[model samples]
Target: MPTQPSLTLAQDLCARLCHDLVGPLGTMAGALDLLDDDAEAAALAREAAASLRARLQVWRAACGAGTGPMTAPEMAALLEGVLGGGRVTADVTALPPGETFAPDVAQLLLVAALLGGEALPRGGVVRLAPAEGGVAVLPAGRVLAWPAALADALAGQEVEGPRQVLAPVLVRLAQAAGWAVSLSAEALTLRPM
Candidate 1:
């Protein structure tokens, strides 16, 4: 196969990452301002706080933004964040036992799921299945392309496209962890091997 141009690829990816992060952060910022200024909106404030906190935590986890390995809280917080948006619902009974993931892995998986969730604008099902080696995220019957970066990362390659900037970091994380990534847009699936 012909090699892709590196500079163009990198720039495209950066633009995508910036694009994804910008929207969520902006929404979170607005929610924070609402909480800061309102006394009567305590319930709404609480929900906003929970949702924003969860989303940001996932963002940090996927980026592995800390000094060392991530703990359970970080992984859980990221999962919670992905779930907090109230857009996608998880059917999690299919997970395996003692299926703990390193922070970076957990972060990648969680964010990938969030990406799948994004495809389901009308809110269908986002189920996480835990296998012996990793989890599988399936976004079924959704009306989106289900971010190609996720599938590429699972296949042990860097992500391609300006709309998928997070692929490199995610690919790096998967490589460092000695993991294999696979995704299918047939229904938006993520499986770790």
Candidate 2:
């Protein structure tokens, strides 16, 4: 089993979340100041608000308290809200339409999506699909480079820092649920143990 996160790691993650929120919050603040004078600013404010909400929702599922069962559409919406506007696009169409994932599995899928996105720095599709043993997170792009730290973490090695936190958390989550996680240049696969 993977070790639990330490208090320091928790603090670092908090800092990371704050850092992620600051940009959208700053945009909203600036837009608010110009809202009275410019119609464009109102549009900007609305966009910023949506972005902020999406980030919060995604983070809640990724790092916050356990969410109950989630359907494929629900997860896809959350992924689209945060990752769609950027270079990466999320594809959950491979997931069954009527099926719901248990809370832990849902969380795993979200984190796996995030991790897959990280590897596609150049832009690509992050796809979630049912695998023979479990689920597969397949990220395809012109170029793919998996972070060494994350790979180490998946291998059950001790890694530090907020950026590297997700990999270990994923390992722990899968372990707790009796699943095995493996990563490759092609995909991240989680299988029943």
Put down candidate 1 lDDT per residue, 79-116, tens digits, no spaces. 65464246566665576434555655666666556666
Sliding window of 10 residues with minimal summed lDDT for model 1: 66-75
Q: For every candidate structure, what is the RMSD over all alpha carbons to the true structure, in angstroms? A: 5.3, 2.9
lDDT of 2 by residue, 59-162 (tens): 89977775778988888888874663457888988989799888888888888888888788888899889896688999889978776777898777887777
- Evaluated at residue 173, the lDDT of candidate 1 is 59
All models: lDDT?
0.58, 0.81
Which ten-residue region of model 2 has the weakest summed lDDT?
Answer: 78-87
- The candidate scoring highest on lDDT is 2
Off by over 4 Å in 2: 1-5
